[model samples]
Target: MLLACSGVLAAPTSVSAVSADGGSRITQVKVYPGSATVERTARVPAGARSLTIRCLSPQLDVQSLQVQADAHVRIGESSVKVQDRDLDKECATPLDDQVRDAEDRVASAKAETDSLELATSYLRTVATVPPSEPHSGPGTPGSASINGTTDTLRRSSQDLLLKLHQSKRRQEAAELALKELTEERNRIAGPKARTSTVTITLASDREGELRLSYQLRGPGWSPSYRAALDSTSGVVKFERLALVAQNTGEDWRNVQLALSTGQPTRSTAGRLPGPWTINVAPAEQFTTEIRAMPAPAPVAASKVTLMSMGDRGAETTPAMPNFDVQVSDDAYATEFTVPQRITVPSGGQRITLSLGSLDARAQLVSRTSPGVEPAAYLIAQLSALPGVWPAAPVALYRDGAYVGQGRLDNNSDELSRTGLSFGRDERVVVTAEPQQQNSGSAGFTGANVERKVQHAYRVESRHQRPIALQVLDAAPVSQNEQIDVVSQYDPLPADKAWNRRPGLILWSETLAPGSSLRFTAAHTLRYPKDARLQESK
Candidate 1:
């Protein structure tokens, strides 16, 4: 007995165990368009000759892993690989124990229900049994005794029935509790049981720190904007925000978060030029094919011009929480390092972060295109910033009320103004009549055909406050040398050159309350009767 006891207590020989190294904790995260970079740090023990650090996540990009350490620590070989891990190992929490307890209670409740059902059935049979003899004359001792027994049996049956009903209700409550607990457990523990592991080996002479950085593919951020314009104050309040999302299978808790406009997944190197080859086609065959093809569609010569007119304006907003972000700007990219630590859970949920706000100078202008839309649109002209402004979705607001949503065009490396259109301004009224055209022969032999058209527009401002108004109109452009096109404007337009769009005329004026304005445009064209004028594209 003594020998057996000693043998049981002795340690086993050739015991094999695989121990994982202490992993590092994430400290910094930089999110990009479709990927993110994670940085972690770990402390090495003093005088440790060898140390290992494990970094694990489900969306880790193994190829982009990098490591660094202090002077006293030297990084050795590192490896990254995907492995299957028990979901319970990482996801199990106190909720699991609670779920088990609830399941046990359900089983207990069902057992009690079964026992109560049996007792109720026995009581029912006893209550149903008829008296042995027929009822004697009333007030007889036999009748009185029988009545007492029957009353006692009926009361007992009712009590059993009530207990049975309570037992069923308890069972139902237990079942409901079990179902809720099960769902909670499933939610806490995700659907997958696999993750990735990154292992790094190092040698250190004294206590030091190790840093690991790697790219992940499952985290990203997008830009959103809010612009509020107060026409009365002539101020525009612009707020830039970011919507960040991540599901890297690892919660980023208390980690420094940074957002960048750069796209890491896109090619970084300059594009390589391919060989330019020219092949001479068979002239006859090409000509034949071209002739057989259908004639190209004719395009209209009408032109519509959109112009912005405004200066900067004051900004107004609620006081913003301090986010001491260090902004770094370069020709290639811009980065903002958030000062505060952020927490993002490991699910595809978005968290909004305030990037910053701008109080750009702006001006309100009412624009009308009577030929297209009779209603006048209230527009705000905002001066462009020096840096790159990536295209994003913007929500427009006017006078503390939401107007509509618009898209911000990409204006990187360009010095230009941005225009935001609020809903139609009912204070301004506009009307346009249909244009009239006449064609007739002209010149000596009647070889030339002349065309003339007239356009007329009327606008009125009914606003209590004075407003700046712009009316846009256009005329046909001549594309053929033989076609001579001339335009005449009543009360010459402010800018006839129409810098970007030819044949477009703009009229700018300041209108007082309850004022009206009218304008007209006349165009004439002359060309050979046999030749058709080509339309301007």
Candidate 2:
């Protein structure tokens, strides 16, 4: 018995669809400084032999496209082709519809205007034409009839002319609308499409999922931070955030996003050492000529010049921590994985994502340089974290109130601490005064000239609580061997040569409420009468 199935079986054919469909989604994104790697997963139907991923962003790096599938599936050759027609089709639909609608309105308006023009012409001709027969006496019926016809024609012509003007105005308005619509369509659709197609062939015994990933340009992210310091608790809440933006021509909807510190655009290979050569210059002998200098009387010393240093109250407690990303550290880079799926639309708008927060130990102190500014600023000494923190703008807060902004310097590998100034502390008052400057000859045979200057500073703390204050001052540093410089401080400074800067000193003290402190710095310079110091000023 020969039995056949009623319905004929059809051969399997390749199916193509834009990756924007529900079957495909951005699974992971690794963003660098100027570009990003996007991974997408697409579901393939069973018994499918081939599939085409359509409408990929033209900005995608074709060489970086990669594909993977289940073990049972045999992946075949993949290709990328620019689909110019597809782009035109994608952008033409709505714009074409609008243009067509506007054109139709314009046509209708022109037709109405033409009809009014014809009616006006007919009435004008009738009013201007002579009577068909010679008029009899004025009181005759024929003359009266002709006169009535002429009056009717004149009134109708005026009415038609008014309508003609109205119709012309309507037609002009419709034409203007059509022109605007055409310009808009041209702006949106452009001359050509910027889209491509990525086709991959696969042979699978059973159904399996496929994933395609590619690196694309025009997407990037940068790190930003918010540092809130609670002076009472001596803790600084440091929050890491990311400002991510993309203009990849396609929206990333409900996708897992990741930010990486590694710059893929940089060279991956280790730099090879180049040849080094050294050359020496020939030596030349020089002769010096000396002339007798006139002996002059000692001049009166000038007044000591005091060097001037080169230069929000809100009570909103930040809501409890709501960090929504996880951080992973690899050998070469740090990755921040967003915990929830997010939608980042195309265009260059930035989406801020909270990476994490940490409470770092911080010491609060008031700092002042009376020679530069009399006001004292609230400063914080923050301990460094394990990972490298890229230099970024830090928003500062003190005691749950907005204070100011500071910068975190993470440019050095050996940086273990950061000092940030919140804002000026008006409660502490400081004043500096220069006392005396004396210059005269000293040493054996009066060969050396001595210059001495004195300065004094007083600081008063009016805060209700005890506060730590640091005062900074600088003394002249002699760069010449003939010039000898020495300094005397009334109260020993906490740090001499602060931050490895010569002649910089810091005086630290703890002041009780309504307490005052005084300090004095005396600088003495001795040099030969004929020699001048390079950096004496």
Candidate 3:
């Protein structure tokens, strides 16, 4: 049924509905990752016998449909029906407009073709007129005059022929488009009506509101964010947004929307251990949840000078792009309530709306993996986050300049902090010195093979102010008991096995303008000469 034209049903229809029936509109929607729960409220006068909510999406889950009324009003059994709209002619559908558009194009193209053909025919007739006796005098039409007239007719005929050909081609294209649209309609409509209706038996003592709620399949939302940083103030303003869309056949106008983390559409029952004999394994053994790659370590380094905080330097706190919203954190879900009523149309277009805004001091730091790349990256760290910041895309602004985009992955065991890299800082250059490696026999009897690797890295800063830089490198970890790995760092690293990740060395230092620090790490691995030891990438 006319998805393009489908609107809120003015009045719900029911066979036994009384005059007490009233208009119903979707008042609230709780949108999850893949589905949404829709709640529609209808107010009826006293002594109402039944209520019906009409024009529901065919994608709704019938088993989850429920109806309730005020305590005084009793809601009885409700039934969902997929009824066919029996009409003398085709009920209006979304494809009808497209079909008519194609028809108009075809008719216009055919008309143009007909006019061009007529003009071409007249020109052909004039140009093909048999050459009569040529008079060899002026004003009597000599060969030159005949030639010019012939040329004009030939040019006109050719132009008209080209026009006719183009018009025919357009006409064919329009006809084909019409055919495809018609076929699509026939296939989707499938000789049946797609409208839906829900009827609930109710007995009301006084004027009360009847709430009908159901789960729909094709409506969901995702989070988006825009963060602006003021370097002088170390303050960051965040504008939180949600991209919401629905293909549920009816427009949700003036609805109270809540973005929810709850997954009601998913199963709550824990998976029980199935009968498993080692020989006869269960069809589905186990499941693994692949977490998103964490954001770079919470390193806070600012491009602006540390002593410049008092100046403000034309960098007033950025105005936060925001909306009125309320956040509710329950045990099962954290929901953000959109304060104002919003409308999400049913054409599957993502409508962006603000969830709210927050202001916090951003901790900035520079991090570089000198072993892997020769550039240092500036990162902004946020220790305190919004009540609920899901994994989404982020647009960053630094010192009033647009930097770039980054993905926010907050699924960390440590929830107190998150970081976003603002791309590379060309001012800080990292140089990896040539590697030194050698192999030799270490045991007294030459029974042990020894491998030694020496790596040196240099990091220099070009910024006017000192920047806190952290260089990441790793020493090899051996799996075998007999394989011994020894690591030595020049001026020892600031944090060994940083963040509990074994063998990962993090070196932290403040580098001044034009100043550099050289870091050396030596790794020696010894194994029995008879055993095979392989290095991995």
Candidate 4:
């Protein structure tokens, strides 16, 4: 006897044969990837009865698919479920295949419409250029006989001018088309592709050890994994989650995937080395949870004391915490003096070593100093400079090897100690000496410089207040190869544009005693690249 089997039915091509295992004939089956999703409808024939559906893909193991007799359907497994109220009504529509064709045509129409709009805009702008006035008056000429000759010349000039204007109009039209295509491509491609959001969350469990939970979610679906933290040290943990795709389209087999903590929107400017592990979690839903483990007794921080020694070999000044010292320039030769017998707490503790103000000088003596000129040996000199060789760099060391940089100053006010490595003897030494700078004489040199091109450069004072620097680049840049200027330095406002000033390529700056500032500016060049290399005559 024929029995009603919900909405499932057999296709009309063949008759159902009785099987030895007493089972109804199986028909259509489809699979999707773990990363795909579906929202619309699939049609079921009227005669089909008793539909048996199963999700077999290992990547996306489906829990269940709920089929309704009339007006509704729900899809998902027992663990995850989504019920659709209008699924039955949507499925009843005829599948003529013409609807898909219509969608494509509509998309094409929109593209053509946008292209036409851009062409119209460019034509309107080109029409607005004022036409050249016709030169009409008594021609200044030799005589009636010369008039014939001049008339021929005037006709040829007018024709050439008209052609040039037409070429420009065509060029403008081409540029507009290119811009419109680029905009449409970006709109279709959507936002830039980026890494998927995968997060591991930590939590404390009833046991002494830490527990972990992992959550992964993107466009299609979300899946989670759970694991426990490491024993003894309850802070660190690891976990993995295997999520089969729920609604990936057919042909969902092998694929490539990975997880990462991408750069967040608000990243701090200056931070310590090692990975940027944020103290707080952003808007992320993890599939896994991690718990804290029992922590061991805390260790003390490392410390070193600085003691002043007198010529008699006895300690003159009281010992104080030895902080790490950094330099304004690492290339500069330096020396660090460390004293023995410093106080440390019972547990392991960390401390910093700092270098105070010291006298330093640079000299240009003959590689083999000739006894002739001592004054000539004085190349340049500075005295009583504080802090490390490199300005505002952190001091760090590990296994007697310098590791990474840390904050050099606490704030703008005073130098601060950058925390040391906890359970190791990491020490840094500085050797004091003078560092030579690359010095040169300024001269206007180079070839692309033309007599017509503007040439300029700026030179400034080191420490004094507002000093004027002159702009020198003014000649046509073709033959002259270099631009040079000499003057004192001064700080300028950030928002203001300095390069726009006539014949200027650089700005000057000045800093007071122990104070410093930095600025960046953009320059606008008036000449073409062929003239850039020309030096000022």
Among the numbered candidates, top TM-score falls to 1
lDDT of 3 at 165: 90
Pairs with steric clashes in candidate 3: 299-365, 300-363, 300-364, 300-365, 301-364, 301-365
Give candidate 1 misplaced runs (Cα > 4 Å): 1-23, 46-55, 87-190, 204-207, 281-321, 410-418, 441-449, 496-499, 526-537
Q: lDDT of each prediction vs. the true structure?
A: 0.69, 0.70, 0.71, 0.26
Cα lDDT, model 4, residue 256: 17
Write model 3 residue lDDT over 249-268, tens digit each, in one string.
66676567788877675666
Worst 10 residues of 3 by lDDT: 302-311
Q: Which candidate, 3 or 4, would have the higher TM-score against the true structure?
A: 3
RMSD of 2: 14.0
Model 1 worst lDDT window (10 residues): 1-10
User: Model 2: per-residue lDDT, tens digit, 198-268?
Assistant: 77777765667788889987577777789888877888888886788776656566566677887776656
As a whole number from 0 to 100, the lDDT of residue 38 in candidate 2 is: 83
| Tens-place lDDT digits, model 1, residues 1-537 | 000000001112244222223436778889887788988887766544444432266567878988888987887777665655453243334555777899899999999889988887756544454556554554323323445665787787788788889989999999999888776544433444345655555555566787888898757887778888888887877777777876565667667788888878766665454565556668655632222334544432211111011111215542443575577898878997776667765555567777777776677889888987898999887667545556788899999999999876547412122277878999999989788989999999999999998989989999998898888887787766888988998868997645467777888889999999888999999999999666642
Give the winner by TM-score: 1 or 4: 1
- What TM-score do all the candidates reach, one by one? 0.73, 0.72, 0.72, 0.16
lDDT for model 4, please: 0.26
Poorly placed runs, candidate 2 (over 4 Å): 1-23, 83-193, 205-207, 279-323, 386-388, 410-418
True lDDT of residue 439, candidate 4: 27
- Model 4 per-residue lDDT tens digits across residues 1-537: 000011222223354421111111112111111122211122333233222222111122232222222332222112222222123221111211233344444455555555555554443433332235332344322233233444675675566556555555555555555455444322322122111111111111111111111121111211122212121221211112212222111111111122111211123354444443435445595444444544644432111121122122235654553433222223523323222222111111222222333322221110101111111110111122243332233333322444443332322322211111112111111111222223232225432222221112222223233322211122122233233322222333321222344333232233243332332222222233233343442
